[model samples]
Target chain A: MKRILIINPNSSEEMTRDIQDFATLYAENEAEVVTAKIEDAPKFIETYQDEAQAAPGMTRLIQKNQKHYDGFLVACHSDPNLDLMKEISHKPVVGIGESSMHSACLLGDRFTVISATTGSIPNKEALARKYNLGKQLTSVRPLDSVTGAVDKLDLCERVSRDAIDEDGAEVIVLGCADLVGTSFELQGRIGLPVVDGIASGLSTLLGFINQALFISKVRRYGGHV
Target chain B: MKRILIINPNSSEEMTRDIQDFATLYAENEAEVVTAKIEDAPKFIETYQDEAQAAPGMTRLIQKNQKHYDGFLVACHSDPNLDLMKEISHKPVVGIGESSMHSACLLGDRFTVISATTGSIPNKEALARKYNLGKQLTSVRPLDSVTGAVDKLDLCERVSRDAIDEDGAEVIVLGCADLVGTSFELQGRIGLPVVDGIASGLSTLLGFINQALFISKVRRYGGHV
Candidate 1:
């Protein structure tokens, strides 16, 4: 069996464990699913500054384990430092954001991303364009109800429902790695596919490993490893 | 079983049959793959003029059969009338070009397209950009060597080799519907993933059918059918 290493950029062990449980369950005997996070990184990666601060530790982790794993998944919805990760690894590095968006595009014409905050909306939209999924994205709705009024999970469900009724989203993407465990429950309530980056990322990387697909190392991804 | 209508958009019964055979084989009990072509369309879809000429017949066919098929696959690599078709149909319409590029993105970082003529290069590049896959595209190489000296299949092999060596392509997308049957043989020789849009499109539509995923019927795809 092949091995795939999934990295959550934040230093939150709780979130990392949640991602691991979700990944292991979704992967389900396809391959061994291993999860890790940047120990020196922020507990919460809510800003561009946090992404930058997380980069060095994340890069070191990827470089150290790139050869040990058949593939890597940068399991963050913002896909922090994804291109740089790909450049340094010979293995296929599937970003959670790209996987979620691309999988949603395959399953539906349009998808709405439910984010942790309004600040992450532009980041998701820009990544969607970069990945060629801009047209398929309906909108990015953030869970701004962080005032401890509604349960966070309930807020996600409400935002997803609104996105479906108003934004015409045929699919929903969980835009934060910490929300990785809510996909199935949310999909059931919203009556649309709710994509989790961790699940889709693992599934995509497994496909690549099955097909023996790797990053192009001739120019853009060359010389860094 | 779910039915997917794959339209060739050309007046060549032979090519339509070729696509049908390939689709039927690849689909393999997942979904019923039905293939057709415009009786009034050009014998070949080599130029934009050909696509324009083929549009009406293709549109009529899709409109007539939209209710019968659970999904649709626009089999030509140019994906002629794709947006219009989506606007008209409630079911999901999977474009071959879109499928090929998106699947390649999921599998690898970069892909090269093999087109039938130099005239189609711009079309493919533009489509790639429109699909947000322009950056992942290494380059488009046309089979302008239709000088009748070498075999067409051999020309494809040589072009693909050049693309891998010079363009740093990790994957190859056959850019014309006519090239659909050549993917496996070419992949064998090239030792890289050569994506046949028909197969990927069929696979994609089947996934949608299984998930009960449809085009969002609220706004962009609302009230068309």
Candidate 2:
């Protein structure tokens, strides 16, 4: 079976557990999933500074586990240090933010990302621009809560409704890794396609491994070998 | 190694050869790429009616080969009978148009499809809407040549330039399967990301097989055992 290492850039044990549980459930039969947390990193990555600080820890985790894992998934929606990880590791490395947004593009035309807090808006927008999805991205709406609280579902629903009715969004992307497994439920409530970045990341990574597809050394990851 | 059957939905022997050569070269040492053509299909499918006429032959090919191939790639960028094939086949089935469009979304933001002729413009537009990419799709510009003539590259370059300038298109998708393997050359001249649907289809299909990811029967293909 393929071994997949899911790295949560933040230091939150709760978030790491949530991601591990979700990955285990989905890939139970086909692949072995191992989830790790960056112990020294910030508990919540809501700002660019937090992401920057967390990068080294995430990078260390990837470097240590690169030989053991068949693939690496940067579970954080912002995908901190993804390019660096891909450059250093010979194995396939996938980012939740990139996979989720790309999957959203396939599911619908206009997609809005539901982030954890207002502070995350800029990072999300920057990611959209990095992927050249500025036009397809309808908006990046925040839920204003860092914790993945059940109570926030109502607020998320309200924001999602607005995105659909007002912003003309046909798809909703759960921009936080903590929001894994909530997509199917939210899709039912919101009456639109909902995407979970964790799931998308895992799925995309699995595809890369199954197909023996890797980041082209000559193209995307040059000069690193 | 995985076996991938690339079904050219058109009858043109030359087009089949082109697809076979491209798939074989790219997927070498990883997957066995097989290309087959529908002998009764039109030499060129520029309209919905032509696509319709070709469906039965393509369907028959899928039914006969479903048991042998590990995955199926509908070679036509129009992805005729895609839903039906997915419903009936147990193995993973991918459409070139869908794969290419999804890959383009990841490579860049907004994209324009370059078609074989003006007659294909309406069909391409309809596909963009079906994929919910009406906004992300800048336009479907034709090479204005049905014969796959090399002279049309200049026209393609000019139209692609206009798409970048006027439509702000960051990626260009070769809408026809015959345009496979030309993206790299075109990207150099156009100074933007260019996508070949054939390569995208094979890559995506390999991902599906590697990950064991499939269109959930409970969701996409209900009641079909």
Candidate 3:
């Protein structure tokens, strides 16, 4: 059986548990899913500075654990330092933000990401630009909630519906790993395809695991390696 | 030293050479890229009937050669019989159409596919819908070219420009495998991201090879495997 390492890239144990549970449940009988987090990282990754601060810890974690895992999934919606992580690791390292956006593009013509706060919108937009999904992205709607807050479900559903109606969003992506299990309910309420970044990341990692695939180190980093 | 079998699905040796050359060039030192085609299939797959006719021969090719290769790529942009091919094979089976569409999604917000003929538009639309990129698709523009015709470059450039100017296409995907090697020129002329399906397919296959990844059999076929 394949083993996947899911790095939360944050210090929050609660968020780590949520990511682990979601990955383990979906990965049932396909592979073993394990979750880890940097002890020195921020409790929440909400800003560019937060992401920058968390990068070193996340990189160290991957370097330390790359040998035991078949593939790696970075569980943050921002996908902090994904390129650098992939460059150094021997395994296939996928970012949740990248995987969900790619999966959303496959699922719909335009997608809206529901973020944890309005402050997160700019970073998400930058990511869309980096991935070349800027035009395909309808908008980034904020839930105005802290990580692991289940009470924002109604607000999320309402904002998502508005995104579909006003922004012409054909799909919705839950942009925070903390919002792992909310996609199904949000999709049901909003009547659009809802993607959880954590699930998409796990599924992508599983695909790599089932095939024993990895990033071509020779072609990566300007083919200098 | 992974090997990828690129099956053109059609019987045209010229098209096969084009695919093999593209895959081999871009794959440089990454994997061994091999190309094949169905001996009795149509010269070009432009319709549902054509795809259906080619399916059996493609299936036979995969079944016979599945053991020698690390992965398989269906070289046709229509991704003929991709599901069935994946079902029967032990390795990752990616279709050029799927790979191009997925890659286009990563490189741009909205994309237009340039087809060989107007008759191929409906089929390309169906593929977009099948992959859930229907809404993200700006339009499907036809080149009005017969298969293997080099004279349609001007027409392709014109239609792609219109797609960018009028249809709001952020990316251009050459919808026919025969149109390989036209992307760089088209990108220069049209000022939009131009994606060549064959190259994208090979790159995706190489990523899987580097990681040894494949589709999870248990999840691929209604969880019956």
Candidate 4:
């Protein structure tokens, strides 16, 4: 069986657990899932500074255990240090953010991303364009949370409903790592395909393994072995 | 079982047969595969004029059999008159081109489209950008065909190798309907993920069916219903 290591680039143990559970369920005996979090990293990767701070810790963990895992998945929606991970590890690497976006296009004609902060909205849009994915992304709607963190399923449901009714979003992508299992219930309520990053990323990585599809070492990632 | 109608806009009955056999195998008894080709249409959809010529016939086919199929798949990589079909048919409609591009994002980072003629290359590139799909489209390379058609798997193998070595294409998409079932053998020869639209599009359609994911009728497609 292929082994997938999910590196959650945050200090939140609860978030790590949530990511792990969802990935394990998604793998469904097809692959083994190993999840970890950077204890010294920030509680949440909401800012560019947070992503920068979490990079070194994730690099160390990946370098130490790269051989044990067949594939590597960066669990945060921002995909902190994803290029570094891909360059260093010869195995296939995918970010939860990219995975969710790619899966969104497959699920529907147009999709909206529900993110934790409005600050993240631009970054989410830019990331998709940069990767040349999420061409069908209609909008990235921010959850109007008082705490400015991903906290409630009710809020995701409401925001997703708006995205559907207002943004012409046929699919809803939960753009925070903390919102892993909320997709199932949210989709049921909305009557549309609602996807989260962790499950989507894991499934994409598994598909890569199933087909013997690996990262191209031709030019962009040729710096590594 | 969910029934998917593959509308081959081209008049090539042999190409339609190839699509049917492959989609049935990929569906794996999960969905019923029904295939049709417009006999009055052009033999190949290599030019914009051909796409325009075939639009009326495909539109009539979808209109007549709209309720008979669970999802509708336009069988050419160019995805001729796709928006029109979606506007007319309320059920999910996907172009094989759109499906291949979305699936490529899942399989690899960078992909190259191996088209039959040099003339169709620009159209393929534009379609991906228009759909906001295939952000990682490294290049669209043409087969050096004397007949200016999709023929000979050997030519596909050679061009795919060049795409990987020269263009950094980790995945090779056989960007023509006639190239169905050619991916497996091509991947074996090149040691990379080689994908075709017919199977890729069918699997994506099935994923939509599995999730009960339908098109957004709130705004852009709201004119019909």
Model 2 residue A61 CA deviation in Å: 1.8
Q: Residue-wise lDDT of candidate 4 within B1-225, one digit each (tens)?
A: 789999999998788888888877776646788899987789999878998899899989989997888999998999898877877776778788887786676555688998988999889999878867546788988886434434577889878877887888877888998888887788777877677788767755665554445665545555645
Clashing residue pairs in candidate 4 (N, C-alpha, C atoms within 3 angstroms): A132-B135, A135-B132
Compute the lDDT of residue B11 as modeled in candidate 3. 92
Better of 1 and 4 by DockQ: 4
Model 2 per-residue lDDT tens digits across residues A190-216: 666677887778877775565444553
Candidate 4's chain A scores what TM-score? 0.92
> Which ten-residue region of model 2 chain A has the weakest summed lDDT?
A216-225
User: Highest lDDT: which candidate?
Assistant: 1
For every candidate in turn, the CA RMSD to the true structure comes to 4.4, 7.8, 11.2, 4.0
**Structural similarity to truth (TM-score) of each candidate:** 0.77, 0.64, 0.58, 0.81
- Of the candidates shown, which would achieve the greatest DockQ relative to the real structure? 4
Top model by TM-score, which number? Answer: 4
| Candidates' chain A TM-scores | 0.93, 0.94, 0.93, 0.92
The DockQ score of candidate 4 comes to 0.29
Order by DockQ, highest first:
4, 1, 2, 3
**lDDT at B94, model 4:** 77
lDDT on C-alpha atoms for all candidate structures? 0.79, 0.78, 0.77, 0.79
Question: Which tens-of-lDDT digit does each residue in B1-225 have in candidate 2?
Answer: 899999888889999999999899988866999999888888887777777888888888888988898989988888887777777776778888987776665444478898888887888888877765666677887787433446656666877877777877767888999887776677677666577788778876775665444443433353444
**A40-69, model 3: which lDDT tens digit per residue?**
789999887888888888888888988888
